[model samples]
Target: MELINNLGLGFTTVLTFQNLTYSFFGVLLGTLIGVLPGLGPLVAIAVLLPFTFALDPVSSMIMLAGIFYGAQYGGSTTAILINLPGEASSIVTTLDGHEMAKQGHAGKALATAAIASFFAGCVATVIIGLFAPPLAKLAFQFGPAEYFSLMVCGLIVSVVLASGSLVKAFGMMVLGLLLGIIGTDSQTGLQRFTFGIPELADGLSVAAIAMGLFGLGEIIRNLESVKSGSMQVSKVTSLMPTRQDLKDIFQPMVRGTMLGSFLGVLPGGGALLASFAAYALEKKISATPEQFGKGAIAGVAAPEAANNAGAQTSFIPMLTLGIPSNPVMALMISALVIQGIEPGPAVISEHPELFWGIIASMWVGNLMLLVLNLPLVGLWVKLVSIPYKFLFPIVIIFACIGVYSMGNSAVAVATMAGFGVFGYILKKLECEAAPMILGFILGPMMEGHMQRALLIARGDVFTFFREPISAALLILAAVALGLVLLPSFQKTRSTALVDED
Candidate 1:
């Protein structure tokens, strides 16, 4: 009954004219970014973060959440039409989505992606509404020791989630932790890694690292492939799916939504993990497993559905606990704080309108995406024909402008250039950048919580194990790390490795 009342209030807040307009605009902008091959929602949000300062807390959150989930809709369009996924979460869609396109069912594949994504988004949002409050109540019990142990576990699982070379991932994580140590120490009021540079005193900008690592890195990588000849874009047919197509996809979509919603709330694995897990699960359970790699409708539907569910549910940690289960959610948390709205268990009680409004906006945004995506498929398909020479230059210019606008600093531009070079080399050396980005986001929080925990524990490390939540998190992290090291896990791991090569 209370949930019902809260949802009614949420609807009232979201139904306001101003919030509705922002939600629409967010979905529109998100679609544009998702359709553009080199760009993703992370870059889009980072680039636009500074501009959102004028918005009220609820409105700003609504807009950002719209873009986050809306991108899931547009991501599959490119994945199906061009065999290129704009976001990491969309990569699994390319496996069967592109294959379906090759079979002259591009429209049907796209339709499934859209409908499944919408359903998953709505269901996941409801789950969040129900679970977030209770979860946040539990989080209120966490002392600094619990928070510290949880962060350690998150970092370890993040490293294990890396697609290749555990050593390199660990190395990158340590480097990120070291970089996180820069600026003045909160406890002793002394500078640690500033090296006497004025900019270093304030600490490295999140905008700088994110834009460089994701935006610039993508540009450089694509530039290297510019001369390697053009890609094969699948031809578009009818824009609507047949009745048989709908029947075939409905069950997988439901399964995916359930699985993704469940997995997304977990600390370490979010959309990226959910999408992959959904794909594997679908293949295992399917009566026609042999059809999975060969244009299976279930193959396309399941992961597409899962990715959006996971994307939506990831907000659970961010909104309720003031912790981000994923890097993208971390970015969202940064945006929330920039608006002076501190997210935690109390956020729901203190700002019911904001919490529920964001939830309501998600459902509204998903509907908007479904209506927007199908009609625009032809326009996006045409984009696939753009020449690499023209595209690569524009990508470089966008990266530079995005980095510049985010911080208003020339040093940030320089930092981007350095990261660009480093990222390129990392790619060349067969190291994955995904885990590095995750590590960079998690490292600071990990350190802050650890120091706080030590202070509260009087330097006794045993306190974490005394708490059930922290203990469970530590054990899960251990199991994940152990699985990565085991010989059997490596075989499955190798096959699922993102063939960035």
Candidate 2:
């Protein structure tokens, strides 16, 4: 009864004439961005955030969140129609989705992706409705000690799951932490890391960093190996899946949704991890493993479901625990902060409308995606034909204009340009920027919690271990750290053996 009432409240809020309009535009624009290669939701949301300042918080968030998941849907179109993946989460989809397109099943593959995504999105919304209350109840259980410990564990999980060398991941995380501290000291009111720059006092702009690294950096990279012309798209037949296609995908979709929902709720394991993990699990469990990647419908079905489910459920930690699981969630939290609404457990009680409205908007957004993807399949294919020469300038202009709009400051442009160059360097080094951004996002919160916990403990070093919940979390972190290091140890030993031989 309570759940139904919450849903009612959400719909009442979302069904407002203003919100419905923005929500539709959000998904429509998200789909357009997702069909383009190298343009992810992270860039899309960051680029468009400035325009939403005039609207109410709920409406703005509704639109941005739509873009986030809408990208997940649009990315599938590119993956199916062309061999290239528009988003990293859709890379696995291209392995089989593109193959299915080659086998003259392009329409069927696209239809399957849309349907599976819708099913997963609906299931994920239910999971949110059921699990969020219980999880938010945790606010009462966590003191500074517990919160600090949890953040530590979250950071470790980030390093463990990040792609590339362990040393490099840790290095990036440390760099992010350093960058996070570049602003004025919150407690002491002292200016640190300003280096005599006045803008540094307010700290680095999130908009600047996000646009520089993801938006401008992407355009720069895409320009280097520029394509002379647009590539051909596969011919899409009837956009209806047959009886066999549905039968094959039903079980896989369920499994993917379940897996994605669980991972997406974790502080560090988000949609990227969920999608990859789901694909790996499906390939491992399929009856005919040999057919797994050779145009298997299940391949397209599972990962698409997983990525969409993961994208929806990734909101869980951000809403309930006040911890962002990924950069996209971090941006959402920033949006809430800008509205003077602190993210965390009390959000449900204090701002029930915002909480439930966002949740309900997800389902509406998913429905919109289903309607958009099927009939507009032809449109997305045409978009794929848009030349990079044309798209790159628009993206570059958007990045510059969006970053400059923040506080009407020119410093944001300089900051974005620096980070754009830095992002390119990281790409050259094969080091990921995701973990670095995660560290940047979580650093201040973790530091604040640690400071408070230590103050409460009167400088006792063992206070973290003395608290039961904190102790268990620290233990878990230690074990995870050990596991992360074990592979490196084994590799080093093997190398030594080879040298001796």
lDDT over C-alpha atoms for residue 321 of model 2:
86
Count clashing pairs, candidate 2.
0
Candidate 2 residues lying further than 4 Å off, grouped into runs, are 488-501
Which parts of model 1 are misplaced by more than 4 Å? 227-235, 391-402, 405-407, 498-501
lDDT, candidate 1, 30-92, per-residue tens: 887777777788877877777788889888888988888878777888889888887778888
Clashing pairs in 1: none
lDDT per residue for candidate 2 within 1-501, as digits (tens), equals 999999999999999888888889989988888888878888888888787778888899999999998998998898888787788788889888999999999999999899989999999999999999899997669999999898888888888777667788889888888888988887788888899988789888877887788777877788897667667689988987889889999998999999999888776677777777787778889988789678999998888999999998999989998988888888888788877889999999999989999988998989998988788878887887778888877877887888788677788889999999988888889787878888888888888888888899898979999999899999998998898689776475445334222
Model 1 TM-score, all chains together = 0.93
Per-structure clash totals for the candidates: 0, 0
Compute the lDDT of residue 306 as modeled in candidate 2: 93
User: What root-mean-square deviation over C-alphas does model 1 reach?
Assistant: 2.4
